[model samples]
Target: MDHDHVRDVDPAVADALEGELERQRSTLQMIASENHVSRAVVDAQGSVLTNKYAEGYPGSRYYGGCEYADEVEQLAIDRAAELFGAEHVNVQPHSGTQANQAVYFAMLEPGDRILSLDLTHGGHLSHGHPANFVGQLYEVEQYEVDAETGYIDYDGLEEQAAEFDPDIVVSGYSAYPRDIDWERIQDVADDVDALHLADIAHITGLVAAGVHSSPVGIADFVTGSTHKTIRAGRGGIVMCDEEYADDVDAAVFPGGQGGPLMHNVAGKAVGFEEALQPEFEEYAEQTVANAKALGETLADEGFSLVSGGTDNHLVLVDLRESHPDTSGGDAEVALEEAGIVLNGNTVPGETRSAFDPSGIRAGTPALTTRGFDEDDCRKVGELIARVIDAPDDEAVKAEVREEVEALCAANPLYEDD
Candidate 1:
């Protein structure tokens, strides 16, 4: 983490890199889509593989001198298949969005219909948001979570599918806390004779550890980011049965991207190896436990938790009901000032703009990676409530900052650095 060579070349960039490392070490990283990767993964990501260009899958590349590249990419593909129990795997997409793009390009035509969850109700932009290419390229329809229960309205989704008759039905979510019924979504897709794409970008590690229900065999295509819960550096993966393997591979390579990020593929290989260890399962279980503890503590402090709690790694807090005056953006800024890092998120039935939504989303993956337990998460929740309760109070923020420093000291991150 010293960045000695970087300092010798460019002192300013070196300072920023060192500062980022220190920031992660000092603050509470509770962002749901973020996690801390092991040093081995970091080293692999910074490896000399970055200098190489592997244009195609293993043993079938268009370029020469791809011997080592073939080996590393095949290792990543094999490990990901073992972890997810998929017949075929592609580890080339630069991100989860690109992974989704591959699936769309492989199976969809221009003007084909796509039905997915709404962005404000726990969906992703790649699913069908007008701002993204997917929305622009396809005829898109959206479904929502039940207003009363704060859960996906499966029945409503079924009806929407019947009317929209989509070519593909996208499942999985971003901010929703409850476990998804993949079979139910698959049934809807089946009835419509449509393909199902399950994006588990937020819970790849949890699924790998058998802590979350997998959609590998059930959905037509399963896609995810290698980071997030997996801590597998930074990349995206797509898994499907062998029948669609060639289509997915070609779509990922020639259709969406050219040369894969070889260094990131190396990182994924290392991180996947690390995740196969028994301890990673414990880490996954503890991450969910910590999220539950955090939600309970926040609920006790009078913060309204969406869906009443969480089933995975994150808890979504709707601030409009409890703290009518404080916006999620307001709480986000104040919490950052107090060294607690999380995001202001849009709730199910969002009343405010996405920029300053009514909710805050927090998770426990990074904290659990740093050896935090349920009790530690509860204390962190209390600190969050305090900051949210009096966002404008400098004295309260100062006190919470001190407590945050103590927590960081107790549960050190990147200590070896």
Candidate 2:
């Protein structure tokens, strides 16, 4: 899309928009929580629906002229319900964090206890980090991953739950590489007579496409970001049984967010339609396969991987053992300079601070979207090893950057534009 109207109205904003588009076209987005949505999704998000102020659910809006808005929101909800086998789905959450907030607002009282995974152990900030509102408003306790195994310590979590008697148990993660056992976590919550909120923000698409186990029926509440693995634009969704439908809807609307982002809801409808296609399953499967290949390549090069590998679209590499001199931030900067874009992440038993942690998390969702296969990801892994092995070497960075350009060309993104 040329966005000629935008250029005519505002030159500076137009240039920035064009620059952002070019950046996406050229860079490899390896952030586990990020993905490349289809062109249709982008168009839908940029549509006229943004002008509407649909402050409530479909067929019942707080504003007028919502017929089209109702249509779009209903379609999004229907598609998501089908995709997840959820008894009820709320597509109005502004983000995954808001989705979590909806659950909290619906069920928990002020100062209620929350048991969640630690941020440094692959948990999200919304899951009771001190910097967030939930931490201040609620009593929070955190569990850790098994430092030696790089997996969730289920036994430890259960013990903690027993001791703490939390009001709710939060599962799912941001940087975790292993597949989550929803049933295990649910059992713990059950034993404690607590609720379970599984935030599958990072694996929404994998769950929908059956590439990973779903937490829909297993957990009491499930939440996710529509833009991440789901490729359904930038928003949040909540799923639960019919009994919690009204409560979830109320919590998401007047309780947490005001007017829904109707344009993004349109984008969700379009993207969810695309996800239902047979090819999406293949894309989801290939994403996991590519991650495995990338992790295997890095492991072969003597890089230490959390959990020793991945069963999903991402892998977390602990740099402390493999590259003691380099921090995750250092490797991340050097890698970005060499044209590979991912994040510096915290690992279990982290020694450094979160801002400059000791781990790097890489995912294959965007690469696979660009038509990259396992072989291509292996090559990418080799480049990563080289750059991290000698982050200060200009010659190596230049060489790798050239290769990155070639790879981008071969697996072209937005080529028509």
Candidate 3:
């Protein structure tokens, strides 16, 4: 964690980088699927392995002299498999979307019926949004959450599955704030003879740390981002039972993507090992606790949290209900001006576009990594409240900025590692 011992980075770049660190320390990071990687993981990502362009799988590389890279890559693949109890893992996909694509290519034929969570409700773009090829190439059916509770009604999902009788069922979300019923999806899959894919991209790290229930043992397919909750670099991973091992591998290699990111693969390996550590579990637990605290504080401040509150890292704060003047886009800019970082997102029934969503999607995983606790979360909620309640008031924004600076001065990002 000490900068004095670190030698690889340039002094000027390091100074510039330190400013970003100061920004992180000063502001709160609430992006649901973001986290700070450990020093070890960062080192692994920056290792000499980046020099190689080793294409193809370990023992079967197109280029020679990939023996060592092969070992590092295999370490990631095998360890990831162990960590998630996955019979097979392809740690090669460029991201969670790419990982999802692999599965779709492997299983569903063009025009095959595929059921997924409706995007506006709680789904990723890769989950067959009409604009995406999945919808154009495949017959896609969407299921929505309950109109009242903002939770997915298992009955409604089943009814859709029965009606569609699709070839694959996607169960996951990007903005959703509760745990999913993987077993129930599996049951529905059985009823429809569909392949069930659970994209736990947001909760993958929590699941790995045992702080959250995982879809590994229950679902036929699992896809995730190594960066999000796992806190590695930008990349994706796919895992499945032995039954789909060969198909998944072939789909990822020849089906979805071309060359593998060997350096990032090495990085994923490091992160997977880090997740196996004991303290990582503690970090995940605190991440959720901080999220709950932030959610409670926000609610207490008169904001309406979608699903009433969060059971995970992120919360969908429907600002329309409280601060009708501020759209998600307005709040996003307002908060950014006050030194806070978060994304504007669509709510369950969001009428706004993604560029100007109706809700602000906030979470605590990244802030908790900076050693923030519940008290910090509450103060962050207050800071966010000020910005949302008075988006145009420069004085309020300045005051919130000062409070954020004080909070950052206390935490001091990347100082503890």
Candidate 4:
């Protein structure tokens, strides 16, 4: 869409870009946290709003000439608030992690206890990773999904809540593949006199489209990424109860970040407005359907799925029986050779290092956005099976890559308008 920039790119770079586009059009993108937004979102992200320096909210910016920037940002906040049914929204935090940071600053003190799902058990890094500020400043206790069923243990969580008496109970996941029973977590938080938060970063689009349950009313604070299923620009939002509105606003501005990314905010506004359309609901539903189909097909091919399978848009493949000598590390490389890009993830009790694990995570949002569905997803499963069956054979990888190209030709990304 930004033709001038594309033209300025070196010839090799341009060719590589074209090739990448071809690959994206062809292969399956089953990464749950990735999606394809419309040209409107792209345009707004590249707009002149990026030049502004609006340090504060509309009608009260820290700098002048932010009149239009303030208008667009406020519209984004209002639209997102309406979409998620939240009483307050802040479309500032540069990423989901920062959104969490602002919430912590607004509500809790340092060293407050935070009860969250364990990272390997489907929790995100910012929730309580030792390397992150969260683990350094707060007392962190983790809850786990039932190893056998791969689901949350509400009873166990309540017991821990009673024992830990944490100050915050955060309900969310990066890869559990099950719907969160946020109401139960809310109850546990209330019994323990803790604030409840939901990090709905991965499922915000599904939540917005009404295909999945939302935590707007259930949790006191909700954090999410605009780029994930929300299909917005690369940024984050923090939504909360009306009572915490000022606290959240001040925390984001003076307490955490400064000089907001006005261009990204404009893009978020366009993305939120697009999300409010009826077609967006259809897109979310289709993405879930594609994910389910892909998961079932892969399972039928004798690949064991982590947590059985996903209830949402991602599936984690356990590569034990398929490649006993290799981890998801090797499998991911093999798949990449075939033009499929996804990340290897650590499944529960994984013995391998964090960089190279036993499981590969895949999802459907991007491919579904490109209009691929059940039939196309099944074919991708077959291709993945082929690649896994011969992870080291260059010929096999090349052959599957060709197949991927053919499949992509059938469903090009961004069909000509």
Candidate 5:
């Protein structure tokens, strides 16, 4: 963890790196889409592989001196295939958004119609949000979760697909807490003769560990982030049946990106190898259990959860009913002051702006990574409730900050460093 080399070159950048390391060690990271990667993975990501420029897949690279780069990239692709049981896996895209872009580039042309879940109801920007390039390039329509149950309205989605006759139907989500019915969505797409793209960016680890349903075989295309619950380094993956392998590989390379980030591919290979071990399964299970405990505790404290509770590693808390005067943005700032870090998210029927939404989404992947259990998460939940109840009270914030410090001490992160 010592950045002596960086310090020798640039003291300011070294100081900033050290500051961020300290910040993560001190604060609780509850952001659902994040996790702490292992030191091995970090080392691999920061390896000499960063100097290589392997442009094409495995053996057919556009650059020379790519022998080690080919080995690392092949290991990543093979490990990912084994982890997800995917017929084909492309580990080149820089991020989850690019993974989705690869699918679109392989399958659809500009102006093709897309059907996806609404963002406020737990969808992502790459699924055709107005601000993204996909939205401008394609004709997009969105579906929503049921108003009463806080789950996907499958019947409604089918009806919409029939009406819109879209070229591609996108499934999966970002903030929604419940498990998805991938088969049902796939069937709807089948009926419309549309391609199914399931973006499992948030729950890739859960799906890989068999805790949640997978879309690798059911959907025509499956995309995910390598980091999140998977605890890999920062990157993206695309999976599909072998029939679409060439199209996907081509799209990910020359279509969207030039040379691959070989350092990240090495990180992915190391992380995937780690995940193949038995303990990673235990970690994945504990992560979901901790989320359930957190949601139950929050509900007991009168916070309204989006789906009443969670089945995965995240809980979406709708703050409108519990604290009528407080906005999610307000709660976010207050909780961060108390050393708990998570994001303000939008709810199903959002009345507020997306920037300062009405809900907060908390997850247990990072907490569980730090060896937190159900009891610890419940205590964290209680701490969150206290801060939301008295967001402006300096006394309450100081008390909560002290407790957070104690928790961090008990569950030390990067202790060797």
Candidate 6:
């Protein structure tokens, strides 16, 4: 991870880069939408492709000197298509938000109706939060997870879709933990003659590995972040049937962005190649297993889990029931001090502000990438429970920090450094 070239050019930026690497090595990154990419992916993202500008798809570039860029981009596309069984893949959007934007741009016009999950109920801002451009552009109506069950109410959504008569229906989620019934959502869209866009940004790898059901074939459009559970470098991807391939490609390129980030495309290619290995399936399985173990441990410690459990790599713990006085932010701060890192998130039926929510969201992707298993995750959960239960206790914080350090040592990340 040495940045000798960057150090020679700008020592300050180099120090920050090295510091970030150190921070990741030391902390437990349980942020639900994040994961650690392999060193190979890192290397590819740091390659010479960053200097190239390929503004169009392979075989049809707007610039010269795109032969290598074409190769890398094509590799990414091929690997991703095979991974998800998508008829078409556009690995060009700069981020997950942009991926969603591409879908909207391709399918809908200004003021067209968009039906999506409510942000506080585990949906993404890009889906239609007032703060985002999509919300400003589209007439948005939001659905919600069941207050009592913490799952999507499909029948309710169907009824809402019929009433709203939206131009597009967005499925998949950001913070919700259970497996989605893509077909149910798609059926709702179909009945209303609306387009279905499934944003699997958080579970790209899980879907690819068959641990979660995919929306590639069922939904009209599918988009995801490459960096999350997929373990690619930072980027986004869009998949659709051949019928909409040109539209998606155009939307991702001239509609939303100019040149493709070829370096990130290279990283995506390498990571997707790694995911095609037999071991990655085991990794996906272990990731879900670890989440279950962590959630169970938290449940045993009196923490109320959303949905009472998880079917994926993430678990959302609502603190309102057990620790009425402590906000999710309060627990987040204390846990970080103890070397455990995760975010405070808005839970279903949230009674607090988004800035300081009632629940903490944890995920197993990064820890699993660092070789953590069910036992290790359970131990981490125990540490989390301790901190949340006694956030002001210095003695408990110290003990938990020591244990976190031991776990980090046991599963070393980037040891070459």
Inter-residue clash pairs, candidate 3: 25-408, 26-408
Quote each prediction's TM-score. 0.99, 0.99, 0.94, 0.95, 0.99, 0.99
Model 2, which residues run further than 4 Å from truth? Answer: none
Candidate 6 residue lDDT tens string, 8-51: 99999999999988888888999988898888998999999999
Could you give candidate 3's per-residue lDDT for residues 303-355 as a string of tens digits? 99888988888888987879877899999999999989999888887878878
Give the Cα lDDT of each candidate: 0.95, 0.94, 0.86, 0.86, 0.94, 0.94
Weakest 10 consecutive residues of candidate 3 by summed lDDT? 1-10
Name the weakest run of 10 consecutive residues (lDDT summed) in model 5.
Answer: 146-155
Evaluated against the true structure, the overall lDDT of model 3 is 0.86
Q: In model 2, what lDDT does residue 321 have? A: 86
**Candidate 4 vs 6: which has more lDDT:** 6
Q: Write the per-residue lDDT of candidate 5 for residues 1-417, one digit (tens) a residue.
A: 889999999999999999999888999999999899999999999999988888998889888898889888899989999999999999999999999999999999999999999999999999999999889999999999986789999999999999999999999899989999999999999999999999999999998898998998899999999999998899999999999999999999899999999999999999999989989999999999999999999999999999899999999999998898899999999999999999999999999999999999999999999999999999999999999999999999999999999999899888888
Query: Which model is ahead, 3 or 5, in terms of lDDT?
Result: 5
Candidate with the larger TM-score of 2 and 3: 2
